[model samples]
Target chain A: MSIIIRGARLIDPGQQLDQVTDLHIKNGNIEAIGDLTGLNAASEINAKGMILSPSFVDILTYLRDLNQIQKGTIVSETQAAASAGFTQLCASPDTQPCSDAGSVISMVNNKVVSAGFCDLLPVAALTKELKGTQLSNMEALARAGCIGFSNASYDISDNNILLRCYEYAATFGLKVFVQAQDQQLGDGHMHAGATATRMGLDGIPVIAETLAISRHLLLMQHTGVSGHFNQLTSAKGVNLIRQAKAQGMNITADVGVAHLCFTDTAIDGYRSQYHVQPPLREETDRKALLAGIKDGTIDAICSAHQPHESAAKCAPFAATATGMAIYDMLIPLIQGLVDAGDLTWALAIQALSYNSAAIAVGKTPKLSVGEEANLTLIDTSHYWTLNSSSQLSHGTNQALANQNLKARVKLTVKRGLVSYQM
Target chain B: MHNLAELQLTKNGELRHFLTPEGLDRLMLERILDTADSFVVVGNQEVKKVPLLRGRTVVNLFFENSTRTRSTFELAAKRLSADVLTLDIKTSATSKGESLLDTLQNLRAMHSDMFVVRHGDSGAAHFIAEQVTPDVAIINAGDGRHAHPTQAMLDMLTIRRHKGKFEPLSVAIVGDILHSRVARDQIHALKTLGCTDIRLVGPNTLMPQGIDSMGATTHNNMESGIDGADVVIMLRLQTERMASAFLPSAGEYFRLYGLTTERLAQAKPDAIVMHPGPINRGIEIESAVADGPQSMILNQVGYGIALRMAVMSMAMSGQMQQRQAQALVSSSLKGEAQP
Candidate 1:
């Protein structure tokens, strides 16, 4: 269907365009930009005070569709993603059978095609079944449409095997995604600090992240591989990444949006919803992460959208599951950051759209003519509470539920199709 | 959601759930101590049963193996005239793959009034109190490294019986403060009970980070930690500490921080030594010191029965009062609707 978004503040970081303009989309591609008021279409959106940007790309997310359909399905999660203004998701490989084999990749692709809410890029496992012992068939899996390779929170204890995996991925010119964490030191549930001590819960020291980042930096440099760090949660970790970048390492990194908004204090009273992997760090670290984003040291911010069933988060803090169902509240949270003046609108859009797309698929999302119409219109002044009735994700494990938030996704056009609308 | 402290109290500040000592104020804590003092008389009587919870059912939900603690709670419930059911959860439905919530729900179906939970995970009792069955009273027996309220109360009772007042006392807690739920609860209770001179004695490795901010001072040397102290409470060093690299050896620990007669002499002449026992004779304390005249170790265990009875009855009464208030409110609403 053809459509027109009229008189909206169109901010496209990829094309370096920011202006109140009208854009025309015809047959799933941008037909024209700059005053399309005279153009007629099948549908029209009067986005007068809204901000329209390229639809977000989440480089790390868990669909949990394979054997854990009880947690989430491809259709449900993609619909949630669409509502959150994300039109592309890089699905992590920690599935039931894992995305190690070419068949798993094809199965995921088939499911995504059938679902058709958004594009799905599967990240194949770096090791067979993610056991960290044997390497997976990376060359074959890459050819089967895997976007990248990752071990997904599982640690490769043997340095030699990890080095070999990096070297092999480098040979195929494939990007390797690393979730840096020292397995032993990351045994605790939350960040190591005074708060964790006060609450009597075990703490995961900051070194768990920095130590892993340091080791991975050395390995990436040694193997000459394209590397990307996922979910950095500490100040030292950000500094290390900055230093590595300054030393001319061709690498990029993304921080989880939750880490930017919360700290170890959020886990007070043992609220299981705040329990996350690479658990939230201190305030200084959160500020450092935001600074890293503002100064362009951190390239992107991901929803890190791990959706789980209610039962997963119902237990005591440590025994409960480790993630928040973030898709339904992702945009409002980023908007909250912008509203609080911690993030500029342009930088937020660039990190969520342009930088994420470039890192994940090596393509920049643009609002120029002839580009695909993957964009969302957001009502920045709109306010709403995220109760169960308003939540769209199948997972009810949202930590931000029942909280008032500014901004809402008013319209999302994916490849000229009305993927979502309020 | 209400915190553990908030969940433990009613609107007017009555005890509802005894989850932790962290939230109980001086008045509430003193009430517990006073109630236990009255129950001490009941313990001395021939027929030691109270009619406070006569028809109530108290379930002893032990997820971890704790023979001593389970028996104390079971006996306390029985003494309160409540029907008691002890479930060794490790060998029960938990092992059969039933979740904690599912098991608690099934038990709640049987109309139990309270759950005395001893779980290995921190905040387990709070989860039960808040999520599983809000109507049922939850008495935390020992939840991970979080709290052991009844134990702390019993220790407080022992201290009060020996020494006059908490304000005039210098209390020293020794060994394994990092991993002891008892230490955490004791710190909170001691602080609330007006004990300002609280010293935590152990190696830096055994001390929890930021515990000093909780109104307790940390000392690596036992001599300085116990100097001028009126009460010395030693925590048991778990055998797993060695396997986990928390210590070099039991002998080494004894040599460094153990409570020997010589170390005991560092405190006041009449200072009392206490251990939440199952104590290691040579590891955390010397046998001579543990069995000495100034040792209040046995008294702490003896006070456990009365202390548990006090908290159980108080929390049950709080729940009953809340339910009755709710009933009155709903009945009044219904009456108004009839008009």
Candidate 2:
């Protein structure tokens, strides 16, 4: 049995689809990219005025499984992920017991595979429980099929330690993602800018992020092993990543929607919900990020969906939580980008669907005759108000709460199977 | 040791216990200075050693964790007298379950004499002073970021050795005056010694909310902060203490509010640098100037120990004498010694 999504504006940046077309799905694979009206399938989805595109992939996610619990379990996470159009999510190792080994990866993978919804690719931890003193069994984790590994949620202070992790990652054929920050310089809890000054908030100087990134990039050059930079939040950050890409180094970078849109100025009303590490930068940095995205410098955009209980971010500016659940907010954020002229439908596809799938499977996503039919159906132009009622994640920290956003998922098909419907 | 003043007793014509800077008068501070002079010279020897604190017990009861303060106290205690015992009870146990009174009671039962007390909550020293039954002395390292009396004394010693007397000199405490225990102690000590025209400098965020009541003028700019002052005291920014308060980034604070060489030039040519250690380098000040010719930072560290030793001995001996009289009366009333 196969599925056919009909009468949709199927935009595949990889295949350069801008006009309305019909897509054919058979046995969980893309059977046809042209007019599929003449072909017959087990199920047909009327996607009029909706986008029949590949489901978005996220390179950062948390999926833990030790003795009992997995991160929301693969079924639960994938259900939530599908509702938000995420087909593949890289499971981070920063879990309950902390994913520091191959058994950890295999344990998580088995649980996700058994749950069966979306692919839960494990991102292994770089150190022994990320202790920063010893290395994890990179070889064993690679054998267990971890796409990438990280120290998770922070940067290691020792340059030698990081360099070794990078070198070890290279041997395992996995890219290392550094959470960029100068540890000693991170004594403060807010962005190092005017808002922190006026509010009397402790600050993590933007230099801290850039300083770590610069060192990591330099080390990458020396080690000749490419590294990935995540959640860049400053104008200096924009230039560093742009320069690194221009220099032809094998470095890839991404930013959260918060950094792209929010700034330290948001703390004007002391909206503690907007608090984040690498603090939301200034308008100047936001503009720089927009420009970076316009170019090929910023390869992807991620949710950076860190879920902390309300008690964590419930405090005043100095004591509030550092992150919010953002996975569901990604589509609306990109929709805003499209409306603002900073992004095109084509570029948005490249950053979200194509690039994400590429990162996961180590290859680009194209709407060819034989590519896998992992497609998400959404009305890209539909305007709807977002609320916590629709989100499936355990956390409700989305900053875009109650905000009007474009697009709502209609159907989520993974591997030619109807995974979800709304 | 219910009262700090009662801790001292004249034993063979020597004062004991160092508890207050007010009583550690000029002669006593000067003697401690001389003692420190010998230690400073001895520090250059093959091994820094003396049998001074050989058998006597010295306990570092810091309820607060200060890298510089603890290390210097340890160094000073080692050089001066008997055994040095550092009991850092800043962890969960001291803050909650085991009360400060209980810990002091347990330690006193062991026959200790000196306690260099540094605590986050105010009145820790006064509370310990009230509960101590042994012939013990309490040295206020710092409390509630309120007053670090020994630091003030050492600063005074440094100033006196450089500027001669405190009666007519102008000294300004720059950087964070708001949450600095050092700033408060410095102000009290300077005011006591008769220093006129003290200026409190830095951003309003860093300066004490109402320092004018203390007879000190407030200045926001580096120029006004140091303007014409005989000695400028730089208070290291207490970044760790910025939890409840949002005091901006160290970079912005440093650029707009830090003390630089040019800023220091607005003061007297003989202006000396003084900071409680482990400088935030680029945050609170510039390195070129902190390590430059005008810095008396190392001298402050050296003087801190001697000042502490003097106060400890004075307080301890006072308590010994008071407790001895009580003991004498109790024995007489009991009609006979146990034997």
Candidate 3:
């Protein structure tokens, strides 16, 4: 199928291109760019008031299914992702039955193919069963179609096991995604600060992330492997990653959209939905995360889209499951950062698409001739409310369930096919 | 704060539930203390039963073990002539795959009009209070380090009887404020009652952060905190504090922050020493200080029943009034106005 997006403001930060142009797509590839005044096409989108950018790539997302279908499923969540304008989402390995084997990776790949909404990249576990003990068959799993290797916050407690896993990953050329959290220091359900104290819930101090990040950064340096920090949630963590990147270490980091939006104060009411892993830090941390993204200290902005069933999140704050359905609200949240002027549209595009794609696939789609037509059409001026009724994911645990925001994904074209339209 | 105080009140600020000491003003605190004043005499009566909650069923839903707190609540309910059912929740249907809501619904069906909840989670009482039907009253016995309103109120009753007024009092609360729901509730209660010079004395690790923001001054040293204070509250140190990195040993804690004869002497000569008992003698308090002449610990226990009775009667009255109002609203909506 051939498609043409007319008069859209194209922002491809990777190629340093930002201009109002028409994009012509044919056979799932970018056939042409610039003026095609008299060109005929199978379908035409009058995207005059839209911002066309390279489709978003989310580095950390939970596509919970298999035994954990109560949380979410591939068909439900990927559809949610499509509407959120995400073209590629790397699913975390923290699902039930832990995605550590080639069989599980192939099962997810098959599901993604059948769902056919957005591209779902499976991340295999670093250790066997993610038990922090023996290593998994990384070479086999990587070849079985895993985008990367990650334990997904499962503590590799044995230092020697972690080093061995990284060393093995480095040799196999598999990207290792590290969730920096010291399990011992992360004793509490929410951030360790005034809010946790006032709520009388135990706290996970900022040291949980920073201390673990420092330890992992040392191991990453020692092992000389490509490491990506996933869902970092602290000011000190931002500074640590910044120093590492400045020191020219092969370390990249991504902050969750929730971390950029909310602080520990959001849990003041003991709202369980606000309870999250590496729980939301203070306002200073939120500011630092935004600043990190703006100054290129953080490489990407991930949805950190953890979907949980309603019953799973309806308990007391400390006892409830820690995560939220964020895929459907990802773009609007990033747009909030852009509208606040804390992040330029170019930087937002770079973090959402270019940087994330580089970490996930080593390549990103572009708005040039011969490039694939994986793109997101966004209406920055459009206002939408994230109400319960509008949700598509099986999990209804949205922390921002009724939040009103600007910016809506008008269309999501994945490989020249109109995957989602609103 | 926990918003439990707000949840406990009716739209017009009547006490519909008694969950936490926060959000209560000096007037409200005084009202509770005043009501408790009359009930204190009732506890001294040969026939202790009152008909205030007659024919009403009060269920003590203790999800966490506390025989002492439960007995006080049970005595208070019995004294108010309410039929009480004490359910040890750990052995109840909650362990038989029954969800909390299901158990609550079953209890409600059994005509349990009031629930006294004690649980291990911080907001467990609030969660139960929120789940109950409109006419059902809920009182928080204690919820994980969050609040113990009745205990705080009883301490207030003890304080007012001894010190006469809160404004002229300088109270020092000693020991582990971090893990004690009693301390948090007392802090809120004291602040609400206009007790300005509230001092929290403990090690930094044993103190809840930002607690001083609730209008109390924090002191790391025990002597400076207790000096010239009119009331001294020595909190019992839990053994778990030692297991955590909060304290080195029970002996070390006693040496640094324990209420001994010498340390008690730092307070005013007439200053009363109080402990929310099951006192850890030699850990949080010395036997001499705990059994000392200035010790109002026994008086605090005596007032506990009266304070709890006052809370139950007040909350039940509020619920009854609200239920009547709801009935009138529904009747009027049906065009059956009495007027």
Candidate 4:
């Protein structure tokens, strides 16, 4: 199948290309870019007053489809990601059986291939069953199409075991994803601050993130391993990652999108939807995270999309599940940031699409000729409200439901095929 | 987000549920105190029962272990002439792996008029009130470290009976303020009752992060906290605090921050000492000071029944009124629909 997108402002930060132009795609590849006025294909899109850019990539997400279909499935979550303009997703290994074996990776790959909507890069568990005890078969997992290795939120308390895991990954030239959190100091449900005090809930201090990041940085340096930090929550954590990169440590970091939009105070009245892990921190931490993104200390922005069934969030605040089903409203939230002048269009596109794609796939996506057609068209002036009817994910536990959003994803193209359309 | 304080009241500004005292105004708090004052006389009578909740069914649902709180709530419900059913959820279907929502749904199906919930999770009562059973009245006996509204109101009763009013009083709450639902509710009640000089006395580790922002002063030393105070409230020191490293030892806590006779003397000459008891004698308070002439610990317990009865009756009446109003509106709409 072939298509021609006409008169859309194409933006590709990786190629520094931003102009209103026509593009031609033939057989799942961009055939021509500049003023393809005579090009004809089987399909045509009149993309006037729209933004055509490389489709977004989410570096961290959870698709618990294998055993927890009640929460979400591979097909359901990928469909939602496509609606939100993401064509690639790196699924975390915090699944029911824990993606620590080759079979689990194969199962996910088979499901993604059958779905045919987006690419799923599985991050295999570093430890067996993610119990932080024995190491998994890293070589076998890589052969099964694992993009990286991580223990997810579970910590390896034994320093010796952690050092060995890093050393083993370094030996194979593998990238290890670290979610820095000292479990002992991270028992609280929300960030340690005045809001937690007023609510009378336990607080997880900033030391939990800083201390764990500090240890992991030192260990990664010692083992000469390529490390990537996931969901940095505190200002001090950003400083640590910044210093490590300044010293030429082979490290990269990203922050969850929810953390950039909210602080601990959003948990007022004990709203269970705001109950996330690596809890929403204070305002200073939120501002610092934005600064880190602007200065390039933070590499990408992830959806951190965890889908839960309604029953999971139907309990008390502390007893309720610890995530929001964010994929259904991810782009609108980012659009909100851009409209408020808190983020620029270039940086937003870079963080959401180019940077995330490079980190997850080890190569940046482009909108130039001869490249595979992976694109998203966004109507920047479109005003829409997100509610249960508008939400596409199976998980209806959205925290931003019924909220007004400035932009909408009008269409998504993956491999030169229309994957999603408004 | 549903505010517990607002959820506890009807649109007519009457008590519908007694969940928390945080958003309650001075007039509403004074009304609760006044209502409890009338119930105090019923406890002294030969009958010791009232017909305020005669046809209502009150269910005491304790998801956590409790003896004193459960007994007081049960007695309060009984004295109000309401049929009471006590569910020891720790050994019931909850322990059999049933979810809290499932258990609540089963209980709700029983058509119980009110739920007296004491859970180990914060905001459990609020969840039930907002999500599960909006029509049923909910009394938060205790929920995690969030709130114990009835306990705070009873303490307020004790203070008013001894000191005559709340405006001229200085109150000091000492011990484990961070983990005490009673302390949090007490701070809100005290501030709303117009007590400006409220002091939270405990070690920095034991004090919550922003107690001062709740309109109370923080004091690590007991003497300074209770200095010239009219009422001194001591919270129970759970032995688990030592195991969790929140304190060095019980003996050390007693030496530094415990309410000894000397520390008690720092308050006013006629100051009353109170404890939400099952108190450790030497850990949080000395035996002499606890049983001293100025001690009102037992009176607080006696007043607890009256305070709970007042809250239960008020909430039941408010729920009835709200239902009646909703019925009226529906009937009027039906009338308009007819030809």
**Candidate 2 lDDT over residue span B133-179, tens digit each:** 43576677776644577788788878888888788898888888766
Candidates in order have lDDT scores of 0.89, 0.71, 0.86, 0.89
Each model's backbone clash number: 0, 34, 0, 0
For candidate 1, what is the total of clashing residue pairs? 0
Give lDDT: candidate 3, residue A284: 90
Residue lDDT tens for model 3, B1-339: 346557778877789988887777778889899999999999888998899999989999998899889999999999999999999877342232136666788888997889998988887777667743545898999988888989989999999998897988999999988898888889888888888899999999988767877778999999999999999999988898788779999999999998899988899999999998999889989899888899998999999999999999999988888888898889888886554
Q: For residues B1-339, write the lDDT of model 4, one tens digit per residue.
A: 336557889999889988899888999999999999999999999999999999899999998999999999999999999999999887343232237778888988999999999988888888889888999999999988999999999999999999987889999999899999999899889899888899999999998876777888999878888999999999999999999999999999999888989888899999999999988999999999989999999999999999998999999999999989999999999999999
TM-scores for all candidates: the values are: 0.97, 0.60, 0.96, 0.97
Q: For model 4, what TM-score does chain A reach?
A: 0.98
Winner by lDDT between candidate 4 and candidate 2: 4
lDDT for A249 (candidate 1)? 98
Determine the iRMS, in angstroms, of model 1: 3.0
DockQ of each: 0.53, 0.02, 0.46, 0.53
> Which ranges of candidate 3 are over 4 A from the true structure?
A35-40, B1-5, B91-98, B131-135, B336-339
Where does the lowest 10-residue lDDT sum fall in candidate 4 chain B? B90-99
lDDT over C-alpha atoms for residue A409 of model 4: 90
Clash pairs of candidate 4?
Answer: none
